[model samples]
Target: MQDITLASAAEIAAAVSSGTVSARTAVSAALDKIARLDPRVNSFTDVVAGRALARAEALDAARGRGEPLGPLAGVPFAAKNLFDVAGLPTRAGARINRERPPSERDATLIARLEAAGAVLVGALNMGEYAYDFTGENVHDGDSHNPHALGHMTGGSSGGSGAALAAGLVPLTLGSDTNGSIRVPSAFCGCFGLKPTYGRLTRAGSFPFVGSLDHLGPMARCVADLALAYDAMQGPDPEDPAASPRPAEPALPGLETGIGGLRIAVAGGYFARGGDADAFAAVAKVARALGADGTVEIPEAARARAAAYLITSAEGATLHLDRLRTRASDFDPAVRDRLIAGAMVPATWVERAQRFRRWYRDAVLRLFESVDVILAPSTPCRAPLAGQKTFVLDGVELPVRANIGVFTQPISFIGLPVAAVPVRIDDGLPLGVQVIAAPWREATALRVARALERDGVAAAPAAILS
Candidate 1:
């Protein structure tokens, strides 16, 4: 019974579909866990206890009547507050939208998941407007890491990250601008997939930086991530940014071996960073991948600079008018950064776009030599809860963007990355990243599976003293 609480959505669904466990039974168990554990961690902003039980009862009835069930039938899930669940206004962890009407319909992705029979648990919290990376939400309250109480969970998917890590839910939806999905996944010791740009529909999800915002799945294990992503990705006529291309399932290559694969370990900025633990996590994956050698993204430092410019400029432009009119409504932790983004020169944005073209080409060239690139997910385990000014190679950086040093450059190039947790044994969780070429999400999942099968990723804190 204790072990069942941590089962993946995939496992739970199979059990429920077979009638070994009913949806109501699963929801009841999960809700019990949330009640017991969440107060200690405060991972969720709200938990929909009544709504979930009702849905579970419906699924149990449908199954009893010999009705067809969806892929995620009866599995419990949640999304960041930025994603609109039906009848719930997308507050996005801010006060400005308090007067806004409740969301009339679920975000497309949320609707699809609900249709697939996954029960909605509640709306998780976030860094307001997805504006900050440190998960410090002055408006919504901070989401703490489940592994350690006083540490920050990476944001704006921070709530989903923390909740999933705490076993509150098996699957969660989180959006990424640069590293929102992967960073929190890294910090919280879970699996998060930042799908290719436009691979997953963004319709109905509140916009952060329209150009870069990507909604993705976060979960406790690789198989669960695949299940959620497979259900989410497809051509949605309503979403212009969603690919018109036909739906491609993510489950096909999950069990495939990584034979004859080209693997490279990244260093330079990726290697030398905040804590030695981060680099060690990357090294463990490199060794598992049979890495040939190192691949340096030349001028990576410049690439990171360019990414920040585009992020801030575009982010500021998106919130500029509202920010001006309702300055007091914004979260202070992220306000100055958003303002800075507004001030970046327009020419810098164009230059960054051109640099994106260059950087993508450089990454593609590297991919020609390697099937996957292994890198650190977060520089250090979530920096001691509320502390500011993390040290990276003895150089100080602001809390927000600094954690994304490796992730930003990769995201700027539109890469697909799988953040897989690695051992950090210091009472803090850590993860490593596996990046693959565009549309090569299969390759990334395969590498992640290999790591899991080979026992590289241990179960969280199996022997905590």
Candidate 2:
């Protein structure tokens, strides 16, 4: 069991199914690791060890009876605190949410993963109200990067990335609005999938921006990423944004090479702002995939601006009541931003919404010419924890907001993106976004798998020392 924490979800499931390893053994190892290592990384906000062991025992009993189990059977996984895990009050990285009653049932995705036989380990830490790019939270302690313990983990899925990076779990769930999932994935050197908007069910999860919100999986391997993503695909009557289209599995086509697909590097807005390491990561992946040509997405910068406006407005509107009643209860930074957003002119928001449609159309037109677009996932690797500023293009910028510069524009258009880690020699890992057309997650995962196979990119286990 020494190497069990580092094993993939598929391997764990296979072992448990064949009785080579019991479900209780796997879950116990995960819980034990969390107890031993989590204090250093601070990835978990709550640990459901008791619940996980109970579920593992139940799964072992089922297998003993010769009953069939799901694909992810006996695998231990966790979700960002925003996901409503039954018996835990969904904190969503806020001090105020701690007062709310415990969730009665698991979030839709959590329930689905459980149905697939994965055990719930716990809920993770995050930026308050899902409004941060740097994973530092004033309420709960900051979620430290597992690769470099003194560095940032990226947010609001900070703990999700850190947990996976620490080899605490092979599967984790995180939400990406502007770049929550992708940013953390990039900074933590893990694989993360941000499916097209409305592709995954958002019901039972805390909302940051109703229009921009997306829930997806993060894992150490592309295959594991596809495994979790494939199981969670379906229409949910509870989520108004959940697509009515039938489920499309991504695992089958993941191994298919990108021979016929036209892939290119993203230029124009995406090509700028980041440092050399960011560009190098993208170029490495592009070279490995034989994608030499570059495609320019029109008005990507403006789209990012529009996304910010929409996110702030929608988020402020969602929490308007709470802001008014409990002003001091929120993180000062998050509270102030929401208050300011609440005060933005309605005409500005309306115009932003109008521009959003135009931007989406322009991006779709590019997809007509290319199957995938490669871009940097983050401008640089993880910054030292508690350090606020980073020099970008010779100018110092705030670390909190600028980390998502490369990621914001793509997510602004609601396109699917798979963040694949590129390991730098003697340096921290960075990531490249393999972006695909709407509802074409299979294509993005295919590209990522190729990079993984070629050894051009990977999520090497983080060294806690």
Candidate 3:
């Protein structure tokens, strides 16, 4: 069972599909691991063990009937609490959302994964209301880093990252709005893909900044990420933001290598504002990829500011009624931010939106010369849990808000980003963001695969005592 839990999602799928392992066996392995390890990590808010076993039994019965299995046959996985799971309230990282009735059906992504033969394990923890950079949920307890249990697993997809790293599950779905996916990926030492905005459906997940929120997969390896990502491709009529483009499978071309792709390191704004470990991680990947040179994306700082403004205003508006009715029920940190956002002048938001378009064009222009841009995913490795501040480049700043400084600019424009964990000698692993043009997740994954092949990046299963 431990070996089953340690296997990658792709490996698990192939083994189960070949009848080497039963779906029930795999799901039971995952549930058992979660039961033992999650109490310390606090990665899950709900573990639907009974549902998982029943789903697995159904799959095993189908296999016995000689039915065709999907690409992700018998793989066990979970989702950020924000994604609706039938019979459970979609928490969206806030206690306030628990008041909502249980969902009648799973979120579109969840349904899609099950259709592909992946078993739904449960829903993981997250930053409250997805309005957080730190995984500390004032309501649900913090999701601890698997590498160092007392450290932070960056949020709002913190639980997704922690679970993957702890080997509780091989694949998990998470939302990336203002670095939710990438930050946790960086801190927890895993592979996370934030597909080009609207590339994946958000039909059943809770919204935190609809314009910026994106749903994608987090896994222990690039292959697992690709397998899950390819399986979820397709537009849903239910999601207005879902792109109309036909499904494009990234797996077939994933290992084609980066011989013809032009890669460059992001400089200027990305080059600074980080500690030595962060910059060194980017340098190591750059050397391994034989990147051509450093290229600057103009006005990135401005773009990050614009992203924050839009996230605040839109998020506040979405919860205006809840804010008015249940202010005390909300997390103090999240509630205060939303309250302040409600007061932001509309003209400022408008200007920010206008500048966002201009900044996106600037980033797009850079991609015209380089196929991929490599940069630090987080300014530093996972910080100690509850440590409030850090010094970067001789300036001290709040830890929670600043963790996404490098990630916000890229996600601001809705570009595809793959966060790959870099191995460090003694400390927690660092991460690099392999960014590509809009809808170009293939390129980013290809680069990440290269790093993995060279052993420069890896998400090794955490050593549990």
Give the candidate number with the greatest lDDT: 3
1 or 2, which is superior by lDDT? Answer: 2
lDDT of 3 at 421: 95
What is residue 140's positional error in candidate 3, in angstroms? 1.1
| CA RMSD of all predictions | 2.0, 1.0, 0.9
Candidates 2 and 3 compared by lDDT, better number: 3
Report lDDT per candidate.
0.81, 0.91, 0.92
Q: How far out, in Å, is residue 309 in model 3? A: 0.7
Alpha-carbon runs more than 4 Å astray in model 3? none
- Model 1 spans with C-alpha error above 4 angstroms: 1-3, 424-426, 459-465
Q: Model 3 compared with the native: what TM-score? A: 0.99
Q: Candidate 1 on 112-199: residue-level lDDT in tens?
A: 8988889988888888888767777776678878777788888879888888878778899999988998889888888889888888
TM-score of each: 0.95, 0.99, 0.99
Residue ranges of candidate 2 with Cα displaced over 4 Å: none
lDDT of 2 by residue, 201-241 (tens): 99999999988899999999999999999999999999998
